[model samples]
Target: MRTIVITGGTDGMGAALARHYLGAGDRVVVVGRSRAKFDALLTSATAARAEFIAADLSSVADGRRVVEHLRAGHERIDALVLAASFVRQRRHVTAEGHEASWVLFFVSKFVFVTGLAAQFGAAERPVVVNTAVPGARADAIDFDDLEMSEKFTFARSNAQQRRANELLGILAAEANPDLAYVTWGPARIVRSSFAGDVGTAMKVGAAVLGKLLGQRPDAAVRPVIGIIDAPSPGRAAFRGAKRRPLTIGAHDDKDAARLAAAVEDGR
Candidate 1:
């Protein structure tokens, strides 16, 4: 059975993915901050095949701790599913002194995929599924203000994070020639717990969007599973089931390297 490591596996699309893999009898390890939520995900039938690591992924320390824990326990990881990111409507700095969204959304994935490289090398067919909506916004990353200490709007913050992830897939795939990297987002809205986490007005708007254009998590996760089961060459991005041509900002090696250096330097 394939071993899948999923972050944010207690809720929404992440939870849906955890359930899917467990139901398929694959060994699953989930990383999340909440013990209660992790407990809630474990049913008697699936409990034996699943594991959880409690991590506040916003902290750089917690991210490293998770990497160390996974390395200690897992010898071969077939897939690393990065579904951990929070919706911070307000500008908040994490305890690690980094911007809340930036750390969880980009840096945490960086730590996991990069730190677990040896484990991935052990597997015959290794892949990293980064669930951030890549190519959703072509907004350039602000190197001067990676933390967004200047003008912090929710849109700009998420945009930069997503763009950075695109670069992440680009660079990571190039670095690990054997590994397949896929960045996927539902072109249609997904009515997951994400809507509930936002502000009241945005929540209502999300609800309406859900009613009009959103899909359930189960439906949205199908394409991702398909790609994982059958590996793709190099790296790719998908908006829903349709694959996006990576001719856009995804192939900018200069920018990708810049982002990688920043993350390594703890930007």
Candidate 2:
């Protein structure tokens, strides 16, 4: 059986993915901040194979903790699914001293993937899956003021974090030629528990948007699962269950190189 590691598996789309993979007979290890929730998943997941690691991805130390925890038990992971992300009400700093959202979405993911490259290197068909937010293209990343405390807009913050995820995925593909990297965008999925963590303004905006255009979380996972199961060569992005040849994200070789370099510099 192939071994898989998933972050943010406590709830939402991540939890959905955990169930999906485990149901498929894969040995699944879920990483999250909630011990109670993780334990509950373990109890209910007897039909499928599953394990849990309580980890807070918002901190650099926790990244190390997660890696060590996994290494102690799992010798290798066939795939790494990075579904751990959070929305902050305010511009908060993580224990790692970086913006909480940025750290979870971009920095920690980069560190985690890079640190565990050796594990995937040994696998025959290792793949990395990153979820992208489609609306993120509207906002540009502000390297100068990452915290966004100056002018925090929920949409803008979400967009920035999404863009970071896409960039990181591309960079990951460039860094590891043997591994396939895939990014996916689930449009207007509302069945997920994302509403609980967003800002008040965001919650209101989402309520309005939901009335206009929102989809069930299961609708989003179809495409996400496709990317995880069948990653494309070069850089590929998926929407729904089908793989799209083209996406709005920057996926050129130069952009991917730059992303890799930036991630290395951050280390």
Q: Give a tens-digit lDDT track for model 2, residues 1-267.
A: 888888988787777777778777788888888877766665454535777777778787788788877777777778887888776766786555666777777777877777787787777777887776433552366655655767877667777776666666655665677787776666554555563365577777877776567776555577666665765545566666656553354444555455556556653
C-alpha lDDT of residue 250 in model 2: 45
Q: Residue pairs in steric clash, candidate 1?
A: none
TM-score of each: 0.93, 0.81
After the best TM-score superposition of candidate 1, give how far the Cα of residue 243 lies from its true spot, in angstroms.
Answer: 0.3
lDDT of 2: 0.70
Question: What tens digits encode model 1's per-residue C-alpha lDDT throughout 1-267?
Answer: 889999989887888889899999999999987778888878899999999999888898899999999999999999988988677888888777898888988888888988888888888899998988767555568988999999999888888888888778767776678899988887688877662246788878877988788889889898888888898757888887899866375447888888888989988
In candidate 2, which residue pairs clash?
223-240
Q: Candidate 1's C-alpha lDDT?
A: 0.84
> How well does candidate 1 score on lDDT at residue 92?
85
Model 2, 265: alpha-carbon shift in Å?
Answer: 5.3
